[model samples]
Target: MLLLGAATVSAAGQTPEAPKQAPTFRSGLDVIAVDVQVIDRSGAPVAGLGPEKFTVTINGRPRRVLSAELVESRSATSMTAVERAAATAGPPVVPTLPRVVFIAIDCLSFDASASRHVIDSARAFIDRLPPTDEVGLFAYPYGPKINPTTDHAAVSRNLATVVGQRHVPLTQFHLRPAEIVDLSAASSSANARDSSLLESVVVRECGDTPDDTCRRGLMLEITGAALYYEGQGNAGLGMLRSLLEQLTGITGRKTLVLLSAGMIASDTPGGRPDISELGMQVGKEAARSNTSVYTLFLDTTTTDKFQAQVRGADKNLQAVGRDSEILGRWLDQFSGEAGGAVFRVQVGSGEYAFNRILNEISAYYLLGVEPGEEDRDGRTHEIKVKTKEKNVVLRGRRWVMVPKRGAAAAGTVSPAPGPAESASAAPPAPPRRVVPADIQAMADAFDRGAAEFQRGLAGTRDLANLLRNFRGSETPWPNAPRRTAVFALELAVAALRSDNQNARDEGGRLLAEYNVRLRQPGDADAFECAWLWTEVTALEGLFMPDSAMLLVPAAIERCPREARLHLAHAIISEQRWLRGTAGAAEVPGILERYQAAVTFSETAAEARMRAAWFLFRAGRLDEALALVETRPPSGTDPYVLYLTDLVRGQILRGRGRFDEAAKAYRDALATWPNAQSARVALMTLLLSRGDRQEAAKLAAAVETAPADQFDPWWTYWLGDYRAYSSIVAKLREMTQ
Candidate 1:
């Protein structure tokens, strides 16, 4: 329901001002996109420079300048022109998608006037028109809203709604240990509720600079599962993932324009607060989805000494205080891997995070090239873009290495090439040899397992137990050196992707069983099976028609040959989680697994994706978005990246950034055009914006879109009314 910008695309023969013909690039030439925050030694954004003043480099080597262009914020004309051109860019040079944008708002410390300025700035951003753009909008505590495929009028309406709802409970809340059964519980559960609520009310509700989320929540209260208790594992990441699975599927590229108070925590009375757990959970999922997250730290201050501040010119990271340090860590860890930058508000300024947020969301570099080769092993390649500029900052992938196996196995000839080479040796590998193995077995096994699971797993409880017992606490089953839980879960998830009874019934049952064993804690290893089940199940939704079972096992345990055999063991103790529902046990198992890989922060992007997978299933979308956005990626991580985009898109849409949400969905579909939820969002945006032709096209795409693993949750994806309201509101404003 998120509204979107629907400014008409520039038509042919419209104005004499239009360039007679798009500047032509030479054939057989390589093109790259570069993002710059140009400045002097003082690090300010240097403007007014032309293309001739820049020089590009790669690996300390000089390179030719194929294309050079600058993007001033809100230059919708240039933005649209670049995007349209890139969409049509063909041959030796393929167009690159826009970088993801993350925005942060600090209601915990801002005053009313400042908040209003921020929201107004956001409104102005929505009012600006563009073509082929992707964006996402988010406000903390209220969950993110998303829109897909849009126009300006839709975005304008959403902006008004957002501006009006700044201080409502949806924006800030009473964090409880668990859902209250009655009004009495709300009164009696004093200690269980977050004491911080008092501060939140005073600072965010009454004194806020902008209370966008809360203002909207006054009349229409948000009612859903209250995420609290250790049992919840990681908030409500599952709902987020289900939503994202579709959003990321629509938008090929996405920018998250987020406004948050940096209040991702749980303060227990007279006990150590456990926000670290929340941080980890959030971080994991954000890494998995390949969602780029940039922050505009508002007025939040961090207590941890890990804080580091660089002076800011635009006042972007000013009040961000020490919180920017932590958020920066998250952003750099994930987006940095892809060569993306994590910008913030100036060190101590109050110019409104919204202004900088709009600038980042509206800015990007455009370039393109047709993929030179096609590799079927589902390999994700790391991409590095270089421009012909001196000291210019470039933001894009470091390399793209999607092979039959995960990224680790691709381009193994790093320090040394093949069998014999030195640090200064020959090229990593010839471009022609880029395509690795076809990975047919992985695809086939996944397809078949989903078919079997959809059809159902066994004939009796004993059979279920037998399946459960296949990998015991101390036993390492077939083809695995240690725990087979993840491997088994992977296969089960693959099966669940299909509509077969075994997949829905048996795979589901196994998930439930593992949950019982790992939901709390029993023996130390009870969570092993549970965690694997969650990840595998989620993957089923990613691979689609192809079976993920074949790759699931290897993916779960793709460590170096010398790594420990028990690397896959769940971190949760059995005594804590051994007594949950057996039928849905996979969910708990997944959490345990995700926590087990917490150290994967030091590992590769794929590991982060795996970690993020568990966070997503654990039902922690915000955290998941944060984590998914952290991973070093090679293009998109298929399901994780797609779902992340989809979820982020929806979240932004619901928040009244219609244009942004639509962009996210559209970008998701660029990579996974077959995603139905993405299609729905896009069509919805188009229709609401009165772009009948595009809306019809989007609708038709949905009708004819290919099947995907997320099909089962299509209903849930579009059920939320917030999304609709976002669109309706934005549509009205933009049309005005």
Candidate 2:
């Protein structure tokens, strides 16, 4: 995806660090330019200083300054000048000078409610900007949705679209199935959590020597987990690198204002590695492009007590602390390398941060120095700038990477030596760092719990422990919000399935907390349909079906086009219809909504699967099979695979194809052996076919299986109660 075109040396003779090979410049001049910001004792920017007041040092050697001039932020007329100059480039070559600014919003790395504040504050900053400032607003990987524009209305429209759809969790790119398997193994030997059956599947999938597969799998798994937990910041970092690449040919000051909660730390406490190469890439590019990257950590503070505990305060502060450490290290390295200083703003002080950036960019002095012949010895020259005036402090780049002699003629820059290429190569990269024993154990426990949940093989306690351990250890923020939310809802649902008093209480509490937050002024308007679904799901998970049913009208009014809301309504309606509280005439309306939900949800595959399940339970065998067949045959998700197979069996059984239904159930069990639905269905199919011995064996396994793992709610909903009661009677007889 990173396509490198004909490499061009900047007018200042710098080449960015290439991804693979070392790069050399092809410039006639050896000028090195650094953007400097100087301020007096009172914290005000010091301007109007001449070239004579400063000294430049490189690689322990002093260099003479060629030019020093203040590049104050200019008006829109100056921006037009740069456009004209770019238009007349190649031969006549009029130099272009425009202050370019990029504002990247990190929607993936912050809470949804808090992100509203970030967007609003950013809008305020944009409104106050002078017409001269051509600003580009980006929502992480998606866009500048509106590119650098001086038009206020354009910015508003683009930003509104961004915030309007903001609550949808950004989908993480899926790793190849083979890669995910290997990644799990490499996370920890103990954490592998795979049974003998799964191991056999992996071996079969690889179709080669298991030893080689194991080795490669280990390497890939570590890398994959790092990528997984890092979230969308991965894409944001890529865009930042690409931005630097684009800025290379442009002339004059460039600034990128990165607004977000913050990126995850490379040294994050868990064994998860930092897969992002952005910090290093950004630093090198910022220096080469003479651009400053100013990060604004949006203040995510809230006064609502329930919101604070459930969605806001403690978590936001934790993010601040984590990002401060991460940003301080990387931002300082890149911005300082580019002679731009980083500002860590306090909560509710986004305006102040913007002001600091404007002040620094508007009044900074641009100084240039011509490197000596020795400076081009194919090594980096460390540059330091200082002033003699009392009470005046100067800030700028401390070093520059210079191309080797005639390496310029090659017209490419090789990647700077990584830790491996350096003398410190003896130590493994952080991603390859050995996962600690305790960390590994915790990871294994989490995976085991997840596997148990996936197959309906877990009890209430299993889910409770997993949820508690996850919250206590991993501490989701900026990295794993979606993952956390999903797990929380699952645990609450599992509690309701088992009739666990404490678990149901926990589920009710989560719904109550979300409901209180939703009722706050303007909160309902800002709520994403996904958030609404979470609350509805919690209500269902707690067995408050009537309460969940009551929420449908308001939810539909709020997000009229949302398919998930319709799906939720369908589930509630179906439950009532089965309980005989609703008429058969109501079924048609419910079916229409199910069809609508399948047609409109972004996660259409899941919606379709659910719709198919409902139809199977309703004895609409042909319709269920037709619906399931429409979905793509391949899926990377294990849960989806299991559900697809299980539903196919149910439909087959309804059609009286007992043998084929039996095969389908076995296939589903093969996909997820601990799947209670598959086991129960297979047992009933055997009984239907008069295979009593096999039926009795399966019934015995079901009786012995962990109590929390089997959810009678789903069994009843799926409409297999006759077979379910028969199996129970058989188990009771054998026990008695």
Candidate 3:
């Protein structure tokens, strides 16, 4: 639930894209980017350098320069204004809200010694943050659990408590210095290994496969935490997706500083000795969701041969020392693709270069440019910020654009695999880009397929053509930005919609057979498939038409962890609740599933708010009220708040408090003046009062509104309002 409101928490992982109008565009997302500053043999803040002072690239290609400005604060921007306002007595004081900074304690990678150092570093980090920046804490140990960071006392208190958990083999946060050395000593007990009794607990603890490795008592807590929301049936990838989707919806900049090892949940492609394909998918999700990972790799020294792909390889290169040729190559490639880099500790050269890394961020530059396109599929784009002069060492944002539909990244993109790998297998090639024609054809096919479906003439081959076209278009990563994983999944959806079940069966067989293949994050086709499901399976209703039911089961199984898909399932399940034909027993299961659907959300907001509506339908008022009060509110999302208000009004009405209910409805309407539900409810209540004048007024209000904004619910009440209104108008004509 804490992850619901955290600045960085959001939907992750999806596929690739190309030049075209998006079915939807997530615009106004602000990126709070920071670059680690580097100097020549001499040290100085390279002032007077404009955008031309630096060169930015993604996969070694250049991008246009937007607005390059230093990280100046509001005080700096408004200094003259502040003085002017101070001189003008009785001037209005502008109220400001806190900019949230999430401080996470990841015990999975940190040993006790490192945990303490991180805590101390966090304290210093917090002190250096903007006064307007209020911090929050969370532990993914058991899910993304929230802790208070606003109060310095509370931060110190929580850090102290978390550090004290002691790195038992069960809770690996507190391994002694000697134990860390033991872990550091191993070349790598890489995923698949045979540990002798003489081997330390650490080696024995991480399982053969990466999935099983972090699956131990405390380390694999995020999944267990996922189970919490999942069991409620609201827990799905959509839960996280929706939250991140909402974050991307906002127009603000956020910098998420992660102080942990590179313990990414990667998919070990093709059963090779690597992580699963989902790890990179998760990273892609992170990117599209508008959060770039800034990893502060704790030097526990265990990362010898073990490549932690959680944070990309490019980030790893920023560190001073600690290089494994294989891992270095991976980091260099991964970081370049993902747009962030790593900071390392140079052993025997004093404390790992924390101070130097800090200076890098302190003197960093943020470039704001108008993305040529409006699509937010988060496709990786090359940024070029160069100095007009030579001999000026420079570093700024290397990658800025987030690839949506993570189709084969336009070039050289390598994503982390999901955490299920057989170490003995070979690694897959890096991800590549799509020909301009491929995605254009994809968009065209979807338009034709959807249109044909509406026309009642869509055939299997039509959809199959769409699938074949994509599959033949590009491989995982033909060149740069190599892992556009989403494209393949989108192909699956297109195939499932085929009038051909034989084709679908073949696709499903492939899913079960090659489940890892479709797990690439931000693959252009793949992410779109996931995002499409979120639409098809809205709690408001399914994203696709009821005809879409044919494809729902197939797509759900493809990415079964999707929360959006589950909520869509609950919408179908709600029909049973509506049908008295199913009798008493069926209704309870309907309510249970609906509630479960929303509760299962990884972020907890999307599903829970939807669940509140289900509870009202089930006549569970107290519970609905509780959910509204406790569940995280997505402040920027007026629709969510509007939905909550309807539930609240229903709950109030069900309790037989008509006046209060009416006022609650009115209040809800006042908060959302354009709400169709509130107006329809008002019109109904007015007709019941026999107030023809009032009824007529309400009826005209809705009648004049745009048809696109028309509420179907209003149609039913239109008769009642119009009947009285007609009579009232006739009587008024006689008097006038």
lDDT (Cα, tens digit) per residue for candidate 2, span 425-486: 33221111134444344434444554544454252245444433332232232254443344
Deviation of model 1 at 563, angstroms: 50
Compare the candidates by lDDT and give the number of the best one.
Answer: 2
Q: What CA root-mean-square deviation does each model show from the true structure? A: 28.1, 19.8, 24.9
The model with the greater TM-score, 1 or 2, is: 2
Rank by lDDT, highest first: 2, 3, 1
User: Residue 494 lDDT in model 3?
Assistant: 44
Those runs of model 1 whose alpha carbons end farther than 4 Å from true positions after fitting are 1-15, 18-20, 23-65, 69-121, 124-254, 263-293, 298-328, 338-352, 357-364, 367-378, 384-394, 397-736
**lDDT values, one for every candidate:** 0.37, 0.52, 0.41
Greater TM-score among 1 and 3 belongs to 3
Tens-digit per-residue lDDT, 406-490, candidate 3: 3332211122122233223443332332544544544444334434332332433355444434433434344422123333433
Candidates arranged by TM-score, highest first:
2, 3, 1
After best superposition, candidate 1 residue 118: deviation in angstroms? Answer: 5.4
Error of 2 at 261 (Å): 1.2
For model 3, the stretches where C-alpha displacement exceeds 4 angstroms are: 1-45, 54-67, 73-100, 143-152, 164-251, 264-273, 285-292, 302-336, 346-354, 368-736
Provide the lowest-lDDT 10-residue window in model 2: 1-10
